[model samples]
Target: MTSHAQSQAIAPKGISRFIPILSIGVLFFIFGFITWLNGALIPFLQMVCELSEMQALFIAFCFYIAYVVMALPMAKILEKTGYQKGMSVGLGIIAIGCVLFVPAALTALFPVFLLAQFVVGSGLTILQTASNPFIVRLGNEESAAARIAFMGLLNKAAGVLAPIVFTTLVLSGLPEVNQELLNTLPEMERAALINDMSVSLIQPYVGMAVALGLLALVFMRLPLPVIEDNTVASVDTLSPASQNTQIWQYPHLVLGAISLFFYVGVEVIAGDTIGLYGSSIGVENATTLTSFTMVAMVLGYALGLLTIPRFVSQQAALLGSAVTGFIVTLGIVFADDSSLLISEILWGWTGIQQLPDTVTLIALLGFANAMVWPAIWPLALKDLGKYTAQGSALLIMGIAGGAILPVVYGGLSGLTGGQLAYMVMLPCYCFIGYYALWGCRKYTW
Candidate 1:
């Protein structure tokens, strides 16, 4: 072959390196789709199952707590099987979980649904354990932020679409349907109608199971490179020796972890509770407002895609986002109870208009949360060499903050009412702000 033709052949081979990373992005999309659907599910399940606020939030607890419970074991599993096999196994587990929804829906049993969600989350823990470190190891460490940012776009885009799709199917027109059924039906028929409504979830989960199965088959066929963890035991980033080694031992990683935890909590709150919050403040049709939250998240992902690396530093993006989060929290706190200011600022730019104040603020939180995960993961995993996988596992565990913080918000809403209950978000943003500033700086140890 001519030298130029040989170069062209090698170029495509080099481009193949990105295929694994791109596949990881697809996994991220699946994760986001499942995770963000909790926003719609919490309220829908609450009404169907007749749950209290605290009880409803158990949806989040069930889903996210799996990360904490399963991260280490998942890491070990990945170590034994390698990324490709581990990912296929994880997807299989998730498919099983999705299938579990059939029984859960048939019984209209809330705890059964929670159990299925936990199982799905356990599977996701394994997927994230493999995918995160895989992306970081794909290329230059310094450029990890940009790659993660690209993944973030895929992840959040799924997050944006999930609520809109699920709500439309399950919750959007339920009241009207219920009203029509009530007018024409006897008491026995009314009970059957309500039960049938809850059971509608079965078909959606069946579709999810089929999609997961196809993705698993495809992932099994893909060519994925394995990246070994190379950090020394004594020098491990998350080791006990490293624990007493001062917070500065890995300033960027620790701060990034903290930022990730708080960012997740805030994002969960925004997406999960906004619909309920809208009801509390007298928005007539609350579930419809959930779209504004997804739209806001989509806008943030769009901005990150355009602006990260080329237009701005990840650190700067994080800092600015933290400040905006703080401001939005304050707006939620002090804004007029009935004003559309929050919704206007969040969705008005897109020609979506007159959203409820609660939803608007929730959507705006999406912007503050946009760059956080992408920025923090790259910074945390930097220079970890061998411990990169374990560190990534720990970061995945930090997702439990989503489980915890929303329950706290729900409890606060129960005690103090929903509008004022947003006070909980203030402290989360405070921690994020701290991480963005002094927390993300270099370590000497």
Candidate 2:
């Protein structure tokens, strides 16, 4: 080939390899933005729709449950078509889901909103199934954790911004609208006024639709590297034949998956429920309360971007994070209300400030949860070879813990008030701690 032609071909091939990573990062961002918005949405929808505490939390349940429902199917689709095509199809699904928001909002139907979230989550499951494994295979097996950590930074960065943007656009104005209606309008007019609040969601979701469409188009044009799995199974590691094997077959991976499941559930409970939690603790302006969690998460991602790979191994990071998570959970549970000791401790040591003790502790969990995914994934899928796709699907399904655990917490809150209910996070962290200490060390099939 001519030198220039060779250069062109080589460049596209190199770019193609990175495209799946990039596209997956974008998909992660979309998921983060959509998923984290629930932090704001639960409270916002609660007021607009006049839902009870438990009822409003169904917002999170409906959205994350799609992972459980769609993960296996997403794996099946990816098996039929490679990751690249599956990613494009996933983005298309998300676009359709985003468009669903328009009609859902117009009708002022809360269930329709939940249904739309389900569709969006379903799309994300497919994208995650395809993208995560692709990113892992992009380089040396040893460095998979580091690469996934980099992706985690991107994912969490989107998560950090999502609540801020959504709250500013859809929720910040709500209190004023509610006040004005209450002061001047009659009872009947209040319903119309509350119904009009749904209109705020229309523009935001329309923007999401446009962005998703453009991304889908870009993914279609990008040339991604085709990875073929060819590793043969031995008694040494997990294989498809291991299906008949005990959950202990891949002890480290299964433990890692369990840790991930619990970590995600706790993280979501922290961010997604903090606004309402703040309200229960007498903090008004739920929209602004989310800034605490968002900022803390941003700081953690910053630390990961700066220190991971070069400065620390993923295992060390995971260990340190689990320790911090346990400490913070304890603080939240046991710290007295009279003293702001936890807040002072976090601010003085970590330089994160201007947050309530409860809120600050929840944000600290973000740091603890930051490296868990990166540390866990490579360990879980280690040496899986040809079964990597199916293994990844199983890991992805663990995300349903995010869906299940929060509902449990929400139900507890309904039964015992939000403050006491936060104790649910303690056992979740305990499971994560167990995984970090010894769960990632399985040396046999």
Candidate 3:
């Protein structure tokens, strides 16, 4: 066993250990709320900013791209600030970013909003760099997946709340306002009306800014535990990529990065695009459909907490998630006609409501995704010991797939129709499943 693993295994047992985990859980909830807000923001920007399908996905791109840009810098920052101060700095930066929404909303500039997302994502990069590996260091290696699952539950519950809350505050009028926004009109008049229609944006983000600022202050004052290790920090022009020439030396780490990259892509697609997908399919209250996905994810996280390391192994959990993801994506492809017979039978008998085929399958992707993140992190960082922080940085950088792949989906949807564009998720899940079965092990590359 690695020294890090052994230390945690024989680590002192007390309420103090749980305190740091609980504190990190709070940070996780904060970022999850922030991250999933992109789901609400994407379509909101479409109408508010008068963006094309591809342009709006820049909302996601900017947010996730910060992880790639800032991961290594954040790692070096953590080396200086330590865990508690690093988290405080992250929260503070996010608060500043949230405050930027005031000017963005006031001017109604899409680029400024994108900038805000970028800044907030940068903050989250630092928080994640510190917290993820720290969570592993907190307890026994075997139970790491369970700890992450518990954190996932907190994370996803905020996800469920975010779209609902954002929709309530920002998008009040259901479809009528959307129809007005989409309808033909004089360009000057349409811009004025859109500006008026989206006047609620400032207040919500101001509230978020204030909340985040207070949390940052609270984190600074809290007595969090310390872990010891030293790294050479290069704030010079030297890039982390160039400095770590030997990063690719770890085959499992590289493969894990690939698996996480594709995993994040589909997870974002399922969470962020579902509302838009529902809208295209003519579902009433399309934005509300996002809650269905989040609810499914919450259930998956809770199940993982109960069963992992006891009823099911971490690798087994990952395999189950990936297989389920593949089945659901296939179900989405054949959703309409395939469900017709079952719909008819169910309606003919008890008269219960039938789900829209696409949204139903999209929602199920949430359950498939929930376990993937919790399982992948532990497996990827399993035995890295001193390299654990850098490994975490690599995996976090892979999260940029969330940015790149969804924009591809959005642009493709515009060309080929939204329903057909969902084919992208299949290959993503296939990679995750491959990792689950084989690629997670050492020398499997």
- Cα-based TM-score, every candidate: 0.87, 0.87, 0.89
Q: Write the per-residue lDDT of candidate 3 for residues 1-445, one digit (tens) a residue.
A: 3555345443445537667878989988986799888887887778888877788889999999999999999988887788779988999899899988888888888889889999999999988888887786677767888999998899989999998898888767533555434668678877777886567788888998999899999999876666543332222124333244355655667888889899889989998898778766666566566777887899999999999999999999999998899888988877882353543443436664345767777877898899988888888876554566788899999999999999999988998888788899888888888888888875322
Candidate 1 yields a Cα-based lDDT of: 0.75
Evaluate model 1: give its TM-score: 0.87
Q: For model 3, state the Cα shift of residue 136 in Å.
A: 1.7
Q: Which pairs of residues collide in model 1?
A: 229-386, 230-386, 231-386
Query: Across residues 95-195, which tens digit of lDDT does each residue of candidate 2 receive?
Result: 88999999988987888988998998898889888888777766655567777777776777777777778867886566554332444777787777677
Pairs that clash in candidate 3: none
- Model 1 residue 156 CA deviation (Å) reads 1.7
Model 3 worst lDDT run, 10 consecutive residues: 233-242
**Pairs with backbone N, CA or C atoms under 3 Å apart (clashes), candidate 2:** none
**Candidate number with greatest TM-score:** 3
Candidate scoring better on lDDT of 2 and 3:
3
Q: Which regions of candidate 1 are displaced past 4 Å?
A: 1-15, 171-190, 231-252, 342-353, 442-445
User: lDDT of all the models against the reference?
Assistant: 0.75, 0.74, 0.80
RMSD of each: 5.3, 5.0, 5.2
Per-prediction backbone clash count = 3, 0, 0
| lDDT digits (tens) for residues 1-445 of candidate 1 | 2223322422345358657667888999998888888877777677667677789889889998999899889988988888888899899989999999889888888889899999999999999888877775666555566777778778877877787788677755455542323547787866676687688788888999999988899998887665655334334444443443333356667666766777788888887888778765656545545556666666776787687777887777778878888888888777676677755664568775576665577667877777777778877765554566677888888888888998989988888877677788888878777776777665443
